[model samples]
Every structure is written in structure tokens, then in C-alpha cells.
Target: MKPYIFSILFLLITSISVAQTKEVLLKKSFKVDENTILNLDLDNANVHIIESKDDKIHFDYQIIFYNYSRRKINDLLDDTSINTSKNQNQIFLKVKNSLYLGIDIKYKPNFDYKNFNNPINDVYKEYLKKYYKTYRKSENLYKTKDSLIEEINFSIGRDMDNYIKKEIDNFPLKKPLKTDKKIEKNFIIEVPKYVQLKIKALESDIKCDYDILTEFKMDSFKGIFKFKRIDGKNNQITSSNGILETYGIKNSRIQLRDMYKVNIGSISNSKLKLEKTKTKIGEIRKNVSINDSNSKLYLYNFGKNFTKFNLTGDYSEINLYNVKDTNFSMDISGYNTALNMNGTKTSFGASKEKELTKILQKKKKENSPFLGNIEVLLKNGIINIK
Candidate 1:
């Protein structure tokens, strides 16, 4: 009887552990106006939204685009297309033209209340005094009356004033009392295993009367896209403007921009039509043995006047278990360029011209456009000019 009882307790503990380790899936959508200057959609897109007690919200979305221009993606990532309050936190990326992407929200909650307690408060007060003394001395040495510098000094002073006021508000005046035991609910939504989504191109049967841009004619356009999955399967879906129906399965959200207009010379008596096709291949896996994870890859192709072109590329990525102190490599190849790096040896290719190469090489060494400390190497080029 004793042995049976012990066995039952062990089984119960195991069941609880298993339940805690399970993953959940969530889906939500926001309405977007089609006629607006920026027509974007998050419908059926896999998005991860998180809310925390720190009075902060976070959104992580995996987005893909179709029939959109690369310039539009660049504008959105540059924050030119969206507006937010001064104190808000925002981040955006155009992984692909047909796929406008971004993660925008307010700052995370403040956990500094812990510093207002007894021992911590004393340490903080001492540090503040030292900081102010050092800063003032440095300002005196500069001795410049430049308005910009003065304005910056004024802002710092105002911030210090606010800090003092906050401290006063948190001052404890009376002994705290223990109230009755009460239940408080806290909720957290873990990041999903997969954000599955699909996007179909909408075609209009009626041809509209429009002026053709002479500078933007093409004989053939071909390219490939690469996608990475954190937990589930990685796949690709392709579509063309001529297709009257929707095409492709997206495991995340899809954001489409406008068609990229190019200068393709004047229209002649002979009628010409442009054709494009994109092929996506298998997932790029890291050779190292590590825990499960996922990533994303983007490709942008802009062509010159009428010409036949062919492009090919491949990518390889390393998986990481502990990103805090681990080093990784991301390799990409296409259009006669290759990027290779470990921690420091990074390179970039922007254009066939020497001037552009120098500019891109400089941008590569700067901070990563993303919020992390990863190094980047960018190589870009154009082809088949008439």
C-alpha cells in the first residue's frame, strides 16, 4: 500500500510539469484602409502580442509581401510612413517589397520600484549625487554657449527634477500593514511555435486606362526567396499579378505594397508584356548541434530597362541556444556576391560601381539595423543594362 501511494504522487508531479511545458497559439487582426496612402494588412498573419505588468505591450510579427515595391518597404522601415508619440517605442523592417513588416509599440513597464525600498534607496541616492557632480564638472570644462548644447543641458536638468518628484511620491511615511490574503491574477502569453498565414493576390478583370512608363519595361524577371522557421515547417508561396486568384501559403502575416515602377523606354507599335517568377527553396540550417530555433531571410531585385535576367542564391545559418554570450554566422549569396563572417570579418556589396561599394562597406560596420549586436555584410548589384 505504501509503495502504490508513492507511485501515485510521482505521477501527479510529472503530469504538472508536462502541462507547463506545452505551447499555445494565438491570432488577432487589425483593420487597414485600402485607400490610405499606405495600404497594409495584418489579416491571417501570424503575430505575437504580449502584455506585461510593467505597463508595457510588445508585438512580434512575421510578415511577407507580394506585388509591392522595395522602396515602399524602405520608407516604412525608415519610419517615414508611420507616426508615434515621443515616448513610444517602435521598430520596422521591410523583409521584402511584397512584404512590409514592423514591430511597433510603447516602452516596456518600469520595474524600478524595487529601488525605492530601504537598502536600495540609500545606494541610489549616493549614486545620483556622484553622477550630478561629475556631469556638472564636465559641463563647466566645455564652457560653450551654443544653443544646442544649452538646450541639452536644460533637458537634463528637467529630467533630474522629475526624478526628485518621483522619489518624494514613493516616500514611505507610515508602517505598512498586512491585509487579508487575496488572490491576484497575472496573465502571460508565451511566444507561439508557429504563426501560420496565407496571402492570395487579388486580380481585377477590367483593364484600366493608364499611361505606361517608358523607362520600366522588362523581358523576364526571376528571383528566389528564403524563409526560416523557429519551430514549425518552412515553405514558400508564389503569385503573379496576372493570376486572378490568390496564391501562396504564408505561415505568418503578409504586408503588400504598390507595384515598383521603373523607366523602361517609350512604348512602340509592338506590344510588350512583362513576366516574373520567384522560387523559394528549403530552410537554411546551421551545422552546429543546438536547440530548436528559427530565422528569416529577405531578397530584393530591381531591374533596368528591357532585358533578360537570371539570379540565384543560397543561405546558411547557425542555431544558438544561449544568445546572450554566443557567436553565430549568417551567410547569404546571390547575384555574384557572397557574405561571410564570424565575429569581425564582415563585408558588403552594394553596386557594381566603386563609389557605392565604399558606402555600403562603411554602413556594414555600423550598428546592426536590428536591436542586437550582430555584425552584417551587405552585397548588392544590378545587371543586363541596354
Candidate 2:
């Protein structure tokens, strides 16, 4: 037998002897007033928030792990230590080490939560504190804010890699060559109808099936987010490297970076900033502004109340359908951009002028002026209006 195959078989036999699966469930609830807000921060978990009729907040945390020792399971439970508190109409629920430096913390199987020289949990906490401190003081720095955040993210990645490798070397003989390990977490939060939500997550899927309250705020990195109805007055979302799908957004301010896919069912009175994203909108109501860079945008339909639209993009593609039926006056300014209005192709920047401007009018009723106004500024892109 080959040496590699023999080693694999040996490891499998060893795993079969000690492999075990376990599940943990934790539930908590708290009462609140009419003006309460739920502030949540977590990482690496599937989180679902449902609207409740009662005047309270309910949290259900579930965890499952396969092929993990009892000691490791205990560590995981400790790492997931949820902190819940209430202060003056504000409720806070924080997951201490939700991801704990990524799932399946296989390194240092016998990790000691009480005493350890280089435990990942401790290192993570310390570095996170430093990172936030740096962020708070970034306004005074010469470097841009985004650059500073990127630098800190890179630093954390490098430091964690080094620490994990160093810890793995300590148990070289006892560490299994191949361990079938998996950890899954599902968290559900039930809140009252009047409560608002503020969430910050990392690599976690966030879903809300019902209508939200008066406010909603989200900041996430690399996750999938879906909300059925966002009936709120103040809403803000900041996400990157993720997928977002939402519907019925009354008002919102959204910033997307490098998103894989985004879909908005119906949105009105909103501001959007996009970077390297692919986005589709079902219908657009009135008073919306969009700034895009290196993105692909699709607008399928327009609402009858759409009164104002302002769009600016560079190196982007925008397609608007069913424009002939809408009552709007469009002012298009393009530089090095292609325009295909009802299959009549036109190129800007071909003439001696730096830019080209065109006006289009579509009246819903005869002798009646356009009900809405649209302004577009684009460069190095394509605009399709049909």
C-alpha cells in the first residue's frame, strides 16, 4: 500500500473512534417598553428576525457540531457566550466570539479558555479593540478612511494566520491529519412590532420575513441579506462582497461594495451608492438618487408617482425598460458613452465637444408637460432606454 493511502486509512480509523456530534440550544427573552431598540452584533451565523405581537424580545440560539471532543465543544459554547442587557429603552445582544476566528476551530483542540498564552479568542479580542480604536481616531490621519479600514482588515488576517499556525505546531503529534469537523449556528430573534433594529455582522446571513418597524440599520461583510418588507422611515445599509434582496423600501440609504447580486422590489425616496455591483430594481418611485461605479444596473418599471431621478456613473451599464409609457423628461449627458434609445444607437464624445447632451420627452397626456424629471451623467458606459 502507498504511504499516503495508509496514512489516510489510519486517520479515518482514529476518527471513527472519537468522532461525536452534539447540539446546543439556548433561549432568552426580555421585556421592553414601546420605544425600545434592539442592537445586535454577531459573526458567522444564520440570523433570522421575526416580528412578534408581544412587547418583548426573544432570542433563540442553536448550535450543532460534528466530530468534536467534549472539551472542544465546551470551548465553542464558551466562545458563543451571548451577552444580553437592557438600558433605558435600548436592548443590546452581543455574541462574544460568534465565529471565533472562523468556524471549526480545529487548531488547539485542547484550548484552555481560562489560561492560555496565545489563545485565538484573546488575540481576536485584543486586536479588535485596537482596530476599533484606530477607526475612531482615523479622522485625524492623513490616509483615507477606506484605506485605513482595509489596512486593519489585512493586518488582522495576517496575524490570525500566524497565530493559528503557531498553535497548531504545539500539538503536531495529537492533531488528526483529517478530521471531519463541522459547526453550524442558527440564531432567531423575535421582536415586537414597534421595536427598531440595528445590526452589525460579519459573514452571516440575515433574513427578516415580515415588515420592519420605524428604522433599520445594517452593516455587514460577505453575507446574504433578505427582507420581505422594509416599512421604515430611517434605513441605512452598508455591505460588501454579499448578496442582498429586499422589497417595499419606503426610505433608505444604501452603500454597496463589490456585491455579487442585489435586487430591490420597490423603493422610493432613497439614495444609493454602488461600486462594482450588479443590481436590479423592479420598480422605482419618486425622489431617488444613484451614484454608481463599474456596475451593471437594471430598472424594469417605473411608478406613477416617480417625480425626480438623478443618476451618475462611470464605467457602468444601465438599462431602463418601459420608458415610453412613463411621463418624464430625461436630460442625458454622456462622455465616451453609448446610448440606445428604442434601438436608435448614438455615440457621445465622437464630436469635438467633450460631452453630449440630449433631452427626451414622453407625455402621458396630450398637451401636458412631463410629470417627472430625470438627469443622467455617465462616462465610458452604455445606456439603454426602451
Among these predictions, the greatest lDDT belongs to 2
- Model 2: per-residue Cα lDDT over 105-201, one tens digit each: 4343433355566454454465456645654464222332234323322221223432444444554343432443656556778988788889998
- Model 1 alpha-carbon drift over 4 Å, by segment: 1-253, 256-338, 342-386
Per-model TM against the reference: 0.16, 0.70
Name the lDDT value of residue 236 in candidate 2: 94
Q: How many clashes in candidate 2?
A: 0
Considering every candidate listed, which one attains the maximal TM-score? 2
Question: How does each model score on lDDT?
Answer: 0.24, 0.71
Lowest summed lDDT window (length 10), candidate 1: 287-296
Residue-wise C-alpha lDDT for candidate 1, range 1-386, written one tens digit per residue: 99999999865654331111111221222222211111112221222223222322222223232222343333433542211121122222111211223221111112235345645445456546855876435422212113322332222112343244435345342222121111111112221112222222122111101121111111111111111211212322222322111111222112111111111111111111122211111111221111111111211111122121122212222221222222222222332233332443334453456332321111122332322122222233211101
Clashes per candidate (backbone, < 3 Å) = 26, 0
- Superposition-based RMSD of candidate 2 using all C-alpha atoms, in angstroms: 15.2
